[model samples]
Target: MLTRKQMELLDFIRTRMGTDGVPPSFDEMKDALDLKSKSGIHRLITALEERGFIRRLAHRARAIEIVKLPEAMESGGFRPRLVAEAAPPPPPPRGALAIEPVHALELPVMGRIAAGVPIEAIAHVSHHVAVPGSMLSGKGQHYALEVKGDSMIEAGINDGDIVVIREQTTAENGDIVVALVEDSEATLKRFRRKGNMIALEAANPAYETRLLPDHAVKVQGRLVGLIRTY
Candidate 1:
């Protein structure tokens, strides 16, 4: 059985998609449900997904597919629609070589990592997300992290964006990386070496760069690519 908020969110999505041919944005959902923050909407969406009423598409902005509806909604003529499908690519010119289709691989979305303040260390996979194979960096293991704050926005990373990271222990100055701090929290920031200390720099000026002893910071992975859903 769905919670009252979950049912309301599901119905809102259904109504918006029926009229707009696409699901509403997170902001829209938040407003419709009178939620205090987008996090509430995220939780409601996840509940619906786990209950088999919806599915979130990977690598697409605001791509949600309604899989099933409650009996009341069904009686009202709601139809399931796959909203993430992209139109076919254009054919190559006669003299040019044909491009191969892009292949997708599923990678574990370990959990949300902070782009502002450091969050609890992510220890286990929360879910899987399909990523384009081309997005994977050279040969090493890669994983995805859902960004949870706006401190990296100036670097093109934003809250709610899923970042694809290549597993690595070392990074050059200015490289965005997931840094485990003091072994208890993890944050996404640019890595810098300053004398014997390591600087975790945020791209947004609103946040000050955090400098800690080199031994206190552990480089978990270097960011290679990013995915965002509108």
Candidate 2:
């Protein structure tokens, strides 16, 4: 929930950064709202920042990135909580059932692995895959993959597990990422790219990491949610 002024600030930050990729300074913010002093704006900004909405540099210019656009405000953001107000339940599985955005698409478990062997062949799909998707924001196609190795054990992904992969191109630092190596193959690892060097790092110390020239790496999608059951 956001106060009226906070919502305005949210809009201000998002409109500036989402369109321009740069944030505004305090003075700029003050001018945008036509306030007499920066204190009023500063107080609201501090509150929004504390609530996990924005990030600000301690002592730098242009230090605000719009994390979430203020879609809901105190005045009009109150959504009715009636049983009848709920959205219709998702459709049944397969064949034109109503599906949420980015759902777990069933895929095959393929084959087993031996060290120094090719990634594996989907000789027969031992099982199906289920990838999750967001109904509100991620209203797109979805798919899943099976984990083959323990390279990401530190990241809590283990061998012989179903790894949900939403197809995308851009991701942030520390996102458990799926990537393509040299256009020849694909692998799962934590991805971090800056400038020319690319590092496909493993979370477990037992596995050797792969370092690639920036041109050789292609980022696929970021990890946002997961599902596991015993």
Candidate 3:
């Protein structure tokens, strides 16, 4: 059995980790739990750890792993459920009206991009999205991808959000870029080069950073804009 506060903490951790690929920071937990200080958050974490609910990852700041779920919560339907029924997407405008002149550039809608784990890139044009030309500031052809996971949620890129990417083969440090690994898999993460290794880092605490040989990772594009539908 878990105390109400403990249950709340556990649920928060689970939801955050599930959606962000990392555990919530102490400040985030404090704010969410309405605690006065980090000490109170520490106490709650310690209690949960002592009961085998979560484990802290050594050498990683703000890192935590859910070891097990509370039996009662799982079996008693205590977890919150997501609403699956979304309103149908508004139909795309067919023709321009003289009253409301819209100037936009249509970009290919790439299949999908894994925001969590690296997945094979589905290289097919599904459709096209009309975006304001002002939003495409970078050079090279721009494409849009449907983000499929929450690994980049902490960076404000949520699952199902369409990200406009500027196609490029190079990126600066700390740029959130689409990276292809071994020519077979792709993921969206912050790009960094340390000595000879390339690291693709997630903004969330739940996912570990991926490191590879410098020649193994290819930069697909840099994220330049985003469009969230509802």
Candidate 4:
């Protein structure tokens, strides 16, 4: 098991590596963690290595490698990565995959769903995103949704933007959530609750705020990012 410090360090490494395509150096980790000295960061890495949580190049300068998870686990669970190439290849890439290799996460354009006034456009799935699998809650098992309307224009969400939505059914107040409203419509808006009233506030004033009883609105997912393609 990883200790708190080791786990935190591990998280930093994984996040940076997965997203930035590089592992953080000892100095970067030191500064990120606010350690008084670079040695402080090294001490933590040493501890992690001792715990079988990470590995490093033998006498290789600047080589701090962590043990990556199995391919099955990498695609199935949440495994933070600080370095992008620390592990082996995942299953062969699917030919139809649209994302580039350097991006952190690439989501398939499923189809478009309504965001504002619900249109009937084939919703020509706008584009894909480069995000980490760990960024989403359910890993590769997670699917993508095409945004349909402009109800969330105020939130910077526009028509045809492929939103990275985490699959979830519950969210905290003030979270930009993808809600299945009345079980018939899915909306992307700010979650607000006041006793019995639940309001989905559209960031853009062009669309009116949606309000309903708590029972009438259900959380679907949280907005993670927007994918815009040329």
Top lDDT hit: 1
**Candidate 4 lDDT for residue 159:** 77
Answer with 1 or 2, whichever has the higher lDDT.
1
Ranking by TM-score: 1, 3, 4, 2
Whole-model lDDT per candidate:
0.83, 0.58, 0.80, 0.63
Instruction: State model 4's lDDT.
Output: 0.63
lDDT, candidate 3, 159-192, per-residue tens:
9999988877789999999888876688999999
Better of 2 and 4 by TM-score: 4
Misplaced by over 4 Å in model 1 are 1-99
Give the local distance difference test score of model 3.
Answer: 0.80
RMSD of each: 15.8, 16.6, 18.4, 15.8
Judging by TM-score against the true structure, name the best candidate.
1
What is candidate 2's local distance difference test score?
0.58
Q: Report the poorest 10 consecutive residues by lDDT, candidate 1.
A: 76-85
TM-scores across all candidates? 0.58, 0.45, 0.56, 0.47
Give the total clashing residue pairs for model 3: 3
Give the alpha carbon lDDT tens digit for every residue of 112-135 in model 2.
321111252222234454433341
lDDT score of model 1?
0.83
Q: What TM-score, to 2 decimals, does candidate 1 have?
A: 0.58
